[model samples]
Target: MTTLSLHWPAYRLFPYERLLAIAEAIALLSSRQIAEDPESVTVTADRPAAAPRLTYFSAYQTPRTPPAPTVQHLIESETSGGSRRQSTRYSVHGLHEYKGKFNPQTARALLNAAGLPKHALVLDPFCGSGTTLIECAHSGFRAVGTDINPLAITIANAKAQALRCDPELLVAEAEAAFRAAGRSRRGRLLADVRGAYLHRWFDAPMLARLETLRAHIVERDPSVSEILLVIVSNLLREFSLQEPDDLRIRRRKSPPSERDPYQAFLEDTRALAANVRVVQRHTGVCNATSVRAHQGDMRTFATAAAARGMISNFDAAITSPPYAMALPYIDTQRLSLVWLGLVDPGTLPSLQAELIGSREFNGSPRSIWERKLVDNSERLPAAHAALCQRLLEMLGEQDGFRRQAVPSLLYRYLAGMRDSFLSVRSLLRPGAPFFLIVGHNHTVLGGHRIDMDTPALLSTLGETAGFVTERREPLQTYQRYGLHQKNAICREELLTLRAV
Candidate 1:
């Protein structure tokens, strides 16, 4: 006769949010029966148990007592409207702004639903900004993440390190670095290509301030320097000539002043440090050594991990893979990438084209990808290959290059995902669960709008790559603001598969 009551957000805006909350409770608590109400879910178990570790529940109670707030509840309460849009940005997760990162709360809920043992190893092959990794660390799980974007690797590792390092020490070091950068004259300007690229994007005074900051950050200890670098990297778009709202490399009509960089750095550092402190108070120190991030292709990460003697077999895998014709990830973060010295300015185009689901391909590389798709069409699922052929046939002579290239781009994207699925399967224990959060997208070609049901296609590919498709759940996405809102995907799907 033990009753555990789980209370979630009163404004459960999305249907999937409610479903995930219930699923997490059921899986974590091993409850016998679940009764639902408008505000809470009451679970009855055969025996009394410790308070269940949860994600979506704001609080839980037993024997009709007052509800106890969860760690997630406390963290979200620190920011306005955090229970909704800001949930993913809490803690060091907000240290840098990264586009297309899935909600950390959703990742947590999925982890809870997986019913993994304490400290179980998890993998995120496309870690993006470490949303899955950070959530794993907070829940006492060991996680390894990989991303092709160098800036993503830097941001992810910095966020994980921030959780392990002393918050006060980090803040003090950041203050000292800022002061030193302000006092120091523009040290050595970045020479040659990188310097030339910076000159084109930033006014002279602002570029000097940024260079000075970079020099001071480079002078600090590696651990401290990484955290400081993320803070400065976040300020790049605002201070640069690039338009902050657009995902593409559009120029800003008005550029920020020289003083704006310093002010932004100080404010961001303080705010981030405060968030880190709050997170530490709630979750305590996460083991820094438990989390690892690599800058490489996901399709080859398994082979690399095996070569490095890293743990190859993981208990579970969770990731939100990039959508077809995905956003210009490199173009949006090129300023940060160049300023952080993560990549060369000259190689930006090739690097962008190399990303899975990238839309930047052209010339010989495009031809090579199309040839590969034709040669290896059998590697993809029948339905997927058929869709590519249909799209190709639908293209008209009047269509532009971007429209005509869709079929080849999609074929290449699916082929890449198939390889990634195989890689993840190699790293996961048999019967381990793999969860992917993906959105559906569409494009108009030849006066016809064709919807790309990416979730279903990836699921079919996953099955072909040694997995069992369990289910696909529809998730209603929140309203997006800004210039990209009109282009945003209105819905997403949560596809659950089990490695075989």
Candidate 2:
């Protein structure tokens, strides 16, 4: 192997000179550890002491205050071969933020540090809540995001694009949608709603106001319609009666309803409009495109729809594929999906897979997935297969136990993900990095544990797709959210696998 070192920014070959200095230290090539002598390392005089790493994962595992695991330690511990693969856990911290959803700070730091060329194409395939795209927009970098769920796509388009729009227009449209909704319902409270999931969660008045927003989103100005959808995408739970932030908790058979829904919508809309401006003024305009929202399965890249188009080439690929057996995104966001006509309420189990350890959060505790996770008990496979099996089983139970769909779906997800990675390889300038963040789903399938740390599994995938796993950031707990159930997946797998 050949190695050459050069100071960044000085080289003028890349934009992330500030980030590159640290990236180089963490991405050492050899198994040996290197320490910088005071003379050899140029420490910035103005910068504050390095921020202590923050604990990313929570709620699930027993928290031992996190210990520092350096890159060398991670490289040394990597198993060379397998007579029998070993079991281990890694804790790495302060990674680039997870796109959207619960993580915001990490997302912002990554954007702040990224100095990609103006209007460079940045892609986040697993854009949860549009954090990457949203941040990308704020950074003045052209970005694209894709997700399997239509609801998620809707939210992404709204937030990322709306951040650049006129706030006054957004507020006006939201108000109009609410008024139209009130008229359609004809003075009935929002609780007289038709949908089961919607009625169960939202207070009557909350729904009344939300319907108005939804109405406006469907019927209004090009800019704010999508923006309104994004608003409701976030507000569904608040308007709903689900205690805590968790949606899977059983809902009241019927909610009695309180909260002036219109006022609530108005308030949220006004706040969102203002926040968009704050972001614009704070970071300047992010360089993302006019949001592409596709509702098709990613695994179906075999279809023409999955084909990359006008914005075909990507400069860098940063994606976080769905965790194994976790995130029944379709089921969890059923209300918004149905309300927006993104998914069909009658066609239940629209998404089931080979996720062997996949389980929903039980309202009380314990998981349906755990029963399946530990079935084998004696031997464990990688988390990927276990999660897959659970998903396939769930799908089987739904449609007279259909067998083919799960394998096909599994092949599709893996193949689709692989294809997307390959496509990313094509788009990147040689040696440009593709930082893919993934979650390793662990569960008991056929009585064995499986850990699909993306680096190892994708070693071959990278080679086939003409890229290399340059550096790895270990997976740690992001949230202990899954702590009690599916006890196997206490740690999440987050990594930054750069291109060859």
Q: Write the residue-wise lDDT of candidate 1 on 395-439 in tens digits.
A: 888889888888889998998899999999999999999999988
Model 1: what TM-score?
0.93
List ranges where model 1 is wrong by over 4 Å: 46-52, 79-86, 185-188, 254-259, 362-364, 372-378, 478-490
Q: What are the RMSDs of all candidates, in order?
A: 3.0, 13.2
Worst 10 residues of 2 by lDDT: 53-62
Please report how far candidate 1 places residue 257 from its true position, in Å. 5.8
Among the numbered candidates, top TM-score falls to: 1
What is the C-alpha lDDT profile of model 2 across 1-500, one tens digit per residue?
21212221111111122243444333322212133332222222211111111111111111233333322122213321221211111111111112225343244334433435556777676665576665455445677676666666777666656666777888878778766775675433443324555666666656666665565567788866766666566556545666424445555455534655566666767766665554444445433454445544443422443354545556665655665345554555666666666655665353433222233232312333333344533122345456555544544333432232333334334544566566556555676656655555443333345444545555445656778666555433322332442332324333455556
User: What local lDDT score does residue 124 receive in model 2, on the 0 to 100 scale?
Assistant: 70
